[model samples]
Target: MLIDTHIHSDTRGLEDLELMAMCLDGVITLAHDPFEMKNVKVWEAHVEKLLNGEIERAKKVGLNLFVCVGMHPRAIPPEVDEALNKIRDYINHDKVVGIGEIGLEKATKEEREVFIKQLLLAEESKLPAVVHTPRRNKEEITKIILDEISTLNLKNSNIVIEHCNKETVKWALDAGFYAGLTVQPGKLTPLEAVEIIKENKDFANKILLNSDCSSNPSDVLAVPGTVLKMKIEGIGKEIIDKVSQKNALELFNLKV
Candidate 1:
């Protein structure tokens, strides 16, 4: 029952070779990123393609999928309201699990505005959220998220504040949102992820494991490798299952 909670299926639309290669990893369920685009029409079309196109294709390769859509802060366009309207409709799509990869990178006013609106929308629609914190100013960006989330009064479990590192993970846990750790190049490493699980034993089950895999082939092994590291280190299988399986399923209200 391995599940990749955040995977960028195709950067420039589906590539048969890449997807087929991904199937060999044998991760059962994958939540693909139907991330925001520079053009609103393209964004809408991409999501449509993901829902109607790659999803079915994924099935052929023995993979099950759902989408996560949002207007990312880093790549946000000028006419965001138009894009948001289109995204709002897709948020309810039967195959769409949540709105995510949506949060501050530069933390500009435009990005913050877009991020907060989507958070409110997630609460309104009773959908879970996948929030991304910036690389350079992680603590600051994470604090901003906490401030906004504080006002919503939504349950911590319903939202996942993703791409967390040591400094930011504590904030998310303190605020009651699920902490997301990505095991990929230059991000949190497998050993680092295990340490978080070790230190935060009580909250280990409240964390989500994701690869955040890009086009890079080695990234595909991130999640599985991390699980193996935990197993060898004597981490309890039940706790490992929480981050690897149950937590994400419960947060996104999904199963495979």
Candidate 2:
């Protein structure tokens, strides 16, 4: 009963692979970056394909699936209005559960503008967002997301800020936003995620567990790895269940 809160639903070559083999009961798929092509025309085409395509990849993997669609901060091209329109079009889809994988990155003016727009859309749609904090200068970026919520008076519980490490998690938890600890190479390890849970037991109510796997090579088994680590540390079964299953389901309003 594992739910990978952040993974790409469209696995490139793993079409025959099974989510059960990976020990996953479900997945929350964030949108692929549209501007990976780096041209407005190409980006627009990708958005159409992304929003309108059938979810064959998830069906092949045989997992309970949910989706989040928006412009990733790094991929927020010049045609952000067009991108937002696509997000708006799909936000109410039954399979779509959130409005993200968006937030600070490089922290440029363009990134900030797109991020705030997505946040507002999430607010208006009453959907939780899957926010991505930059790998570099993570704390500062996390603070920027928090500051935006304060400035706009957005609800904290409406977003789950991802990739939070020890130093940045407290800010998110203290502010009432969910803290998503991602397990991946060069990020939080299974041991590290458990340690953070141990360190902040009182502030861990909305803690989320995820693998952060995508088309790019990363540990797809990281979510299960964290559960194993938590067990090894004698963490309570209830705590593990909350982080890996219950919290994500509650945050995204998913059931599977």
Highest TM-score scorer = 2
Off by over 4 Å in 2: 15-22, 34-41, 44-54
Summed backbone clashes in each candidate are 0, 0
lDDT computed for candidate 2: 0.78
Model 2 C-alpha lDDT per residue in residues 76-195, reported as the tens digit of each score: 667778778877877767788898788888778888888888888988888998889988999887888888877888764668989999999989888888899988887888889999
State in Å the error of residue 111, model 2: 1.3
Compose the digit string of candidate 1's lDDT tens values, residues 136-171: 888887888888778766653478888899888888
Q: Over all chains combined, what TM-score does candidate 1 have?
A: 0.87
TM-score of each model, paired residue for residue: 0.87, 0.91
Best by lDDT: 2
